[model samples]
Target: MILVAADRVLGRGGALQLQIETVAGDAGVEVDAVRARFPDVLALATAVLRFRQEQWLTGLAAAAVGISEPRDRILALFSYLESCFMDDDWRGCAFINGYGELGRAEPTIAALADEHLASIETHLRALCIEAALPPYVADGLSLLVQGAKVEAAIHGTTQPARSARMTAAMLMSVYEPAREDLFI
Candidate 1:
């Protein structure tokens, strides 16, 4: 409950704004109750960060559930994110924000941020390998995804995801000449 409240708070503002009192109130529990579970704002923030990151990955997996083709599975994940871009409350990725806000002050946040990025890379790489795509496809797709994420967050538009999706298709086609028709 506390972590969910913290995530809601984080969804509204930066990590620094996540307060124990706010969480307690949102969670419908006493401040002491909230404190009993999370001794400090940093600890609460850390838990929420992990929660959101895991939720993101789980949701991505769920998105690709019915997908059979490896390349389609990868595209399905990006399409899931493209749909997320339609959410009005979306404020970019919380893990990335957590790192930007308090990563230097707290090493754990930095480590968790690194872990989340690495997980994303691993997922992309695994999908690319399954698709028999060039190794560079996964690396390039990761870069494009990260770049698109930043742009979408800053500009409050879905164009970044569309551009990233198009560029990813183009990149894959380069390594998969036989599938050029599918790409087009």
Candidate 2:
């Protein structure tokens, strides 16, 4: 275990140390700690943590939003994705790696991801009730959306988004009517 100091701004315009353990021991400590020792350390840490939470929530929301009316669901999905891409640190993006540090540690990104997934599941169930659709159908749609996200991110394309949109369209196409009003 390596002790890395994450500096926090003090009352007198100085800084304090916040020690974090790193996998690469001293080397990692030096690199990660250097950035943390700034005057606005606490603010920097907060920003980083919040960004991580938002990223995790965005992915979860993309699927969970479908539990509402189609318009609202699509709105939620679009809003979250917009936040993600607009983030300053986004580099074509990647998924969170370690879960251990998040919930218990200062950042708590992993916990955010875990909680967001549960929320998504709940949203799907609620949407089903609202749509008067079978509960199992909602469950299936949620699973499909999850799969689409994973595949899209893995392949580094918009295919996942397209697939998810198609799946949602299918769900909304429950009515076999030959009228435009019956289409989603």
Candidate 3:
């Protein structure tokens, strides 16, 4: 239902009440029932946002880290991001969009978005460690991931993913010498 009413939920300056009603109708449920089931709409929306964000992040992590070579892993990650950008249903990062929509109104939603982004950072950090890259490389890659998402969404193009991939390759090259020094 979120996908069905994404325009209403994510579009500029719509009344929350009307958005909820439209979502409820699309979901084939009474608005009152939806309200009864989730009195705190922000919390419910945050949960959905987290779910969607984690889904993509986790999938990307798995695809990246599942490969054997460091360069291959980075390529895998870039490929995944490119595919996401090209997806017909792609509508940007859900957490980012949700935060833009509800962050100021609901602090909990903001916190949830932060937590979700942090989780992605943690996962990327782990991948960096596994790849024997410098610790700070994870942070740079995380920023690249986020920037690519925003750029792709805004421009409706996969160019950002390609650029991010080139950046990641450069970062990996800088840290490649340290690979043998790390215990992991």
Candidate 4:
């Protein structure tokens, strides 16, 4: 039911009241019980944001299987990006959507979303370091990832992920000359 709520809330641009009512109707519970369970809408939104992040990270990890080489890891990351774009539940990004809907009206929700993005950035940075790539590469890739998400949502296609992957491969070639053969 929480998953349903998250999807509806994000899909409808953070209509918390409506989403809660919908959840209540779907769950056959009273609206008051839903409210009692989630006294703070922002808190519920935060949990949904965290849940979305975990979903993304889990996908990334699964895509990165047997990825020992840095170049392979980059490819894996790009594959993950494509998968995210292709997901039936894809709606830009949960954090970005949450921020767009509630950032101005609810600072706490915005902060939670910001923290979630930062966590993703930190994880990507760690991957860059593990790959022995320059530190800035992580930031660059993070931007690419975000851009691809937005583009994918707007175009309703996975082409953005493919484009980003090609660009990332070029960047990787420059960063690790020894791995140039891998890309070819």
Reference-based TM-score of each model:
0.92, 0.46, 0.79, 0.85
The TM-score of predicted model 3 comes to 0.79
**Model 2 per-residue lDDT at 101:** 27
State residue 136's C-alpha deviation in candidate 2, in Å: 3.2
lDDT tens readout by residue for model 4, 61-143: 88888878866776788888898777776768877877787877988778877887787688778877877788788888888
What lDDT tens digits, residue by residue, belong to model 1 across residues 90-141?
Answer: 7887877889999988999999989988888888999898888975678888
| C-alpha RMSD values across all candidates | 3.3, 10.2, 4.3, 3.5
Q: Residues 1-184, candidate 2, lDDT per residue (tens digit)? A: 2212121111111112222332223334554554454334344444434454464666755555436464346434534444444444333322232223233463444555465555556766776656555666666666665565455444655555565666666765683235567677
Whose lDDT is higher: candidate 1's or candidate 2's? 1
Best candidate per TM-score, number?
Answer: 1
Per lDDT, what order, best first? Answer: 1, 4, 3, 2
* Distance from true location, Cα of 182 in model 1, Å: 16
* RMSD in Å for model 2: 10.2
Residue 150, model 4: lDDT of: 85
Clashing pairs in 1: none
Instruction: State the lDDT of candidate 3 residue by residue for 30-84, as single tens digits.
Output: 7776677556556447545656666676877677665787657756777798988
Candidate 4's TM-score reads 0.85
Which is the winner by TM-score between candidate 3 and candidate 4? 4
lDDT of each: 0.85, 0.46, 0.71, 0.76
Instruction: Kindly give the stretch of ten consecutive residues in candidate 2 with the minimal lDDT sum.
Output: 3-12
